[model samples]
Every structure is written in C-alpha cells, then in structure tokens.
Target: MKQTDFVEVKQMQVKCVLCDQIEDIDDDALQAKRLRNRKLNMYLCTPCNERIAKNTKKRHKSGNFHLFKEKKDTNDYL
Candidate 1:
C-alpha cells in the first residue's frame, strides 16, 4: 500500500447530528479524535452550532433562562 492510500483511509466522514450535514475531517484533527474517543460529544456542523448558540443567547436576554449549577459544599474543605 502507498502513503496516499493510508491518507485516504484516515480521512473520516462525519455527519452533524443536528442538521444531518456530511463533512469530511482529518482523522488526526482534535475534533475527530474527540468524536472517536467520546460517545457523548456528537458532531454538530458550524451552522447548527452557531444557530444553537444564538438561540441560547436570545433566551438569556429574555430573563427566563435558568441554568442549574451544582452548589459547592463548603464542608468538603473540612
């Protein structure tokens, strides 16, 4: 096998879970590596991620969005 064959095989085709858009990413890229290693981090195309971020910001401006954060226990330091 030639080096080109390895390169071609290393290229990964991923689909965005939100928009179903297909994108080719280098297997050695950090995003590709994360996707391959982690099950929870699903792929999202640039557009979908941007749209979601925009909506989240709009919700925040409405003053009704609440983020539940875990309260740190001060007793843990004892």
Candidate 2:
C-alpha cells in the first residue's frame, strides 16, 4: 500500500513501568489511545496486575489493611 497507510497501521510499543516488560499494542486500541493522551495512566501487564490484585486481597483478609483516602475540605461553604 501507500506510505501513509503503513504509518497509520503501525503498532505502538509500550513498556510496563511496573514489570519493565515491553509490549506491542494495536495503534487503534482504546488502551493505546489513553496511554498516548494521558500521562498518569501507566501500562501494567496482565500478570503483574493479577499478582497485585491477589496480594491486595490477601492483605485485606488479614484485617490490617488500610486504604488512604484523600480528605475533602470541610470549610468550602464558609
């Protein structure tokens, strides 16, 4: 095909910040688009994500887990 078509169809290469694994994602996928536009959303491979979820569940079961939630200002109406 044409050079422009080839450029548009190219895959995006991204590295997982947590596991340092390089992965190729489709250029048109939603994840790819989010990563391209948002700086705070990092890529995590499936394995790493699953492992983290498992560990979080385990911690929750131990009755000592705490999640820090940001407090909203109470004086905003003043």
Candidate 3:
C-alpha cells in the first residue's frame, strides 16, 4: 500500500498592456489582490514600467512635456 498527496499552487496570469508580455503572479500578492478587487485592470511588466518612467523624466527635463487642465463651463446665471 502507498499514499500520495499533492498540494495545489495558485497563480494569476496577467498580460502587460505595453509589450503584451505574459507573466504569472502569485495569487496572494498585493497586485493580484488589487486586480481581483478591480482597482486597476492594466498591468505593465517591470521593464515597460521603468522605460516609461525614464522617458517621462527626460521629456520633463527637456521642457517638452505639457499637462492640459480641464476647462469647466461656469453657469452663466449667477
């Protein structure tokens, strides 16, 4: 007679929005929890996230970056 047992592992598969890279995340991880709670749907791999940050800093230093403020129409009858 013999006894065998196996434990199952939990993994969440996520795709990177920028490079479309497929990666697995531990189900108990905070990022996975956020996704499960629908806080954010987009996922970016480490490389893509870093690249964007680097480029944004360069653009900001070059004075070519701009953030447009939203215009709101005020009620004319005041």
lDDT of each: 0.78, 0.76, 0.79
Residue by residue across 5-25, what tens digits does model 2's lDDT show? 667676888888898999998
Clashing pairs in 1: none
Cand. 3 TM to true fold: 0.58
Question: Best lDDT goes to which candidate?
Answer: 3
- lDDT string for model 3 (2-72, tens) is 34345456899999999999989888888889988999788888899899889989987665423321122
In model 3, state the lDDT of residue 38.
Answer: 93
In candidate 3, which residue pairs clash?
none
Q: Which regions in candidate 2 have their CA more than 4 angstroms from the true location?
A: 1-8, 56-78
Off by over 4 Å in 1: 1-9, 60-78
> How does model 2 fare in lDDT?
0.76
**Residue-wise C-alpha lDDT for candidate 1, range 38-61, written one tens digit per residue:** 953798888898999999889876
Estimate the overall C-alpha local distance difference test score of candidate 3: 0.79
Worst 10 residues of 1 by lDDT: 65-74
lDDT of 2 at 28: 89
Query: Each prediction's TM-score against the native?
Result: 0.56, 0.54, 0.58
lDDT of 1 at 67: 34
C-alpha lDDT of residue 59 in model 2: 85
